[model samples]
Target: MQAVKNRNSSINSIVESVFDKDAANFWLQKFNPLWSFNQALGKIINKDQTAVDTVSLTIQTNKKFKLGEAGQHHPVIVTVNGRCFERTYSLTQLDVDHVLLTVKRVDQGIVSNWLIEKAQLGDVIEFGQPYGDMLLPQPSSPLLLLAAGSGITPMYSLIKAALKSNVSTPIQLMYWMKHEADAAFKAELEMLAEKHANLKVQLFHTQSEHPDSRLNESYLNQVSNLENTTVYACGPSGFVSTAEQVFKSAQSFKSEAFSLSHLASDDVGFINVTLTKSHKTVAIPKGQSILVGLEQQNIQPTHGCRMGICNKCACNKAQGSTKNLVNGATNTEPGHLLKICVNSAQSDLTIDL
Candidate 1:
């Protein structure tokens, strides 16, 4: 048996030395689309409309894919019209080989629209290793999950994980949506709350007949042990900011925003951005992310999780000034690392792209 194993290893080494991996994988994919040398690929097996303009897809991934923590995000890559596009989304692991990806349609969003309208069952998509920090901690504390609109997706993942782990602490979720019909996993969440005594689910609709007020201090009355609970909030930038202010008294706070709010900047008009590696210069608008500006000029940079937490979009600012959109901080230092997804050009800049 040992000699046979050694012979097989020798044969494999010879085959690897003789054939290029890309060439081998090209032929391998002809038999099975998900087969690859090392790439993580998933096939869409099921699709369901979870809410108005929201969809949930069941993806069965190849063995190369590594499952991430409950609240982590994965960089999903797909090609549309021969052009590859990558976007990050939170995934809920259903089992060892399956995950649920929920997407909400955004107006003028190219990838979201394609995933909703064009992607079909048996279609294969590429995935990057999961990246995020908002995860459940050991020796758990009470959890306060605050979500707005599509933000509920990650919270749902965290909730199921917490319950499955037998976390005894109270888990309270407050989700806000424009209308009740916009709520994804409404019945599922209610069912979970019914089954788990420690889990509490609340839905707030701002556009309903009896509208609920937006995030404010008054809502704090409903949450018990406010000062002892760890809080996780996800939503639009404005909603996250409001949550941060409202839940300042929590034991610890973590947040991720799906969209960034436009920064109010005195640096108006376009600024020239010089790409050092490409030896090209383009003018991009101030007060907007450098990533968006680059995309406007059809310059695609490798990026994931546009929320700035993934660090995949970080590049060196070789010269000039930039302002951090999240905190409104300015940096004029040369050769500083800048996350193009969250930093706006404040002046003519040269970047190591």
Candidate 2:
């Protein structure tokens, strides 16, 4: 028995040495397209047009995929034109094996356009671990959810989870879009509001004949128990900033911005960025994100969720200064970690690519 065990162990070691991970995975994928040595993959099972420029995809994930909280973003990776790109999208779990991802087609968005127009059912995509902190609070308080444009995705997930949990707290959702035709989940949200007496749904169209003003202090008037409610806002940076200021007195406030507004900085002009690994130097614009600057120079670094939540674009700032675009804070420390997605080069910098 001891001899047989030793022989079996030797054979296993030989097999491991012969079949490297990539070779093994290639064969595994041939048998099952979603199978891999270690990759979270999902197949597009269903697709539906949610709005004029939005589509909701139902993805059936493999066993490697892990579900996240209601209000979190997942880094989805897809190949477009022989190049891999990653984008973070808010997902709603439909069941143990499936989740829903809604994407709005931006005018020039590469991943969005591809996902909307090119991806088909049975196509597999990769998903990284989910990230975000705007989850439902414990011991639920009366809730106020504010969303604009595609920001409604996560709020929809949170609202569904909150309602399904049978939390008796009042949930008021105010969603703003350019037009009524751009509203996603309108009928579903209305049905949910009708069934739940504690729920309220309001849609605002900013470009309608009777145009509603953008989110402002006056919007707080519609939210009852503002002092006691937990406020969650998602939108462009400007709208989120406005929501934060107007709801400053709420019990708790959390927000996520899909697009960051550029910081108004007195420091203008170009700064040099030296990529240590690539052994290249490039001039990056001051007061703009390093990731954007690198992209402008055709240097595509690994990045996910350009809004700075995933930390996939973080790198070592070996030298010089950078400014955090989100908070307008400057850091001059050397050998510190920097997230290129939300930080701008402030000086001649050495970075670990």
Q: Rate the local accuracy (lDDT) of all candidates.
A: 0.92, 0.91
Residue-wise lDDT of candidate 1 within 1-353, one digit each (tens)?
Answer: 99999999999999889979898779989999989987999999999999999999999999899978999888899999999888889999999999999999988888899999999999999999888888996679999999998899889999999999999899999999999999999999999999999999999999999999999999989998989999999988778878988999999999988888765556779999999999999999998999999999999897888888799989999999998776567999998998999889989999999
Number of clashing pairs per prediction, in order: 0, 0
Write candidate 2's Cα lDDT for 135-247 as tens digits. 99897899999999999999999999999899899999999999999999999999999999999999999999999999998887798888899999998877887898899
The C-alpha local distance difference test score for the whole of candidate 1 amounts to 0.92
> Which ranges of candidate 1 are over 4 A from the true structure?
1-18, 264-267, 274-282, 318-320, 327-336, 348-350
Q: What is the lDDT of candidate 2?
A: 0.91
How far residue 175's Cα lies from its native spot in candidate 1, in Å, is 0.7
Q: Which ten residues in a row have the lowest lDDT in candidate 2?
A: 256-265
Q: Give candidate 2 regions above 4 Å deviation.
A: 1-18, 263-267, 274-281, 297-300, 316-321, 327-337, 347-353
Score residue 149 of candidate 2 by CA lDDT.
96
TM-scores for all candidates: the values are 0.89, 0.87
